[model samples]
Target: LQQLRSLGQPPRPVTSTACVPRRSKEVPLCPMEQPGETQDAAALPGPTRWPLLGSLLEILWKGGLKKQHDTLAEYHRKYGKIFRMKLGSFDSVHLGSPCLLEALYRTESAHPQRLEIKPWKAYRDYR
Candidate 1:
């Protein structure tokens, strides 16, 4: 470690900067270069959102939790493939397209965790 500093070659700032090994020029990946590439919520489709309650009032008006399925189905019909809505404190984006679901499911193992509740996976696998 001391030898690197002494030789005037400082260690790379971030490991993901490139595919090349030590002493080679770093090739910045697109996402790494422009870090703030997150999807803008304002661009997504959905009903009017109140600051505190978000779209919760709309959900309730449509039929509350009991008819959440119907409300969401209505939302899908109104808002195309993807939409963002907040029910109480949960701010979530719902994807209605099969392609979007496929993409999301493909990345499942990216942050794999132990499944303590077997029924969740069991139900999904059964389908």
Candidate 2:
């Protein structure tokens, strides 16, 4: 079919850098400063980002391991699917929908490399 031929054709690769038009440095482009904002700034929430630790503290404060799983699930329930949460000081996870999580688990795509450890940390180690 014509559509299949089009799909088979090689697509263009994206260039990392493109020439951008230079603008005057004097004029600052503050896109956020617009008139008559309808949205509430505070209520437009993310995963409880703090001053020093950001959401890292929140994740730690909830305890680690299974606790993190529970909290992430809770947040998913409250904030819909695809919610952002911290995992210790170094990691921020954007957890997908329940269906996606299930699919990942079913496909063995969730941290497949973690199984190679001498002593597995998670319950899935038994597999």
Candidate 3:
């Protein structure tokens, strides 16, 4: 009966660690970073992007759908093996190396589910 009655009672007041004062003078950086080295992801170069629309306008300006392969090749030459680009609301990273592709293929699930099947679904419904 006492244990059941305790369940209805409010939680006890707790002291937060944030409220405590630190003895150290220097603040620690992110755990992901080493002492001297910077993050590799931040160093990668890519095209200038606009807010909300991202790099969509820049990609279209290069030649739209007709020259997508050419544009990617141009970017590959400019940005090296790896580059980041955004289209409308979508953001993606492009890898131009065969070794990276092979590694990704080896690591990927055997039965990966396809997310971009709207066109196939539409065709099936129409048929």
Highest-TM-score candidate:
1
RMSD of each: 12.4, 16.2, 17.5
- Per-candidate Cα lDDT values, in order, are 0.57, 0.41, 0.55
Q: Which regions of candidate 2 deviate over 4 angstroms?
A: 1-45, 88-91, 98-126
Candidate 1 lDDT, tens digit per residue, 43-104?
67888788889988888888888898898888889987677787666667777765444433
Residue 77, candidate 3: Cα error in Å is 0.1
C-alpha-based local distance difference test score of model 2: 0.41
Tens-place lDDT digits, model 3, residues 26-73: 211222333223334435578876888877787789898788789989
Question: How many backbone overlaps does candidate 3 show?
Answer: 0
Number of the top lDDT candidate: 1
Q: Residues 1-127, candidate 2, lDDT per residue (tens digit)?
A: 0111122323222222121114321111112323212232233335776656667666667885559777676777776544444334533334344433432233333234332435554547777
Model 3: lDDT of residue 8:
32
Better lDDT candidate (2, 3): 3
Q: Per the 3 Å backbone cut-off, how many clashing residue pairs does candidate 1 have?
A: 0
Candidate 1 to truth, TM: 0.54
* TM-score head-to-head 2 vs 3, winner: 3
With a 3 Å backbone cut-off (N, CA, C), the pairs that clash in candidate 2 are none
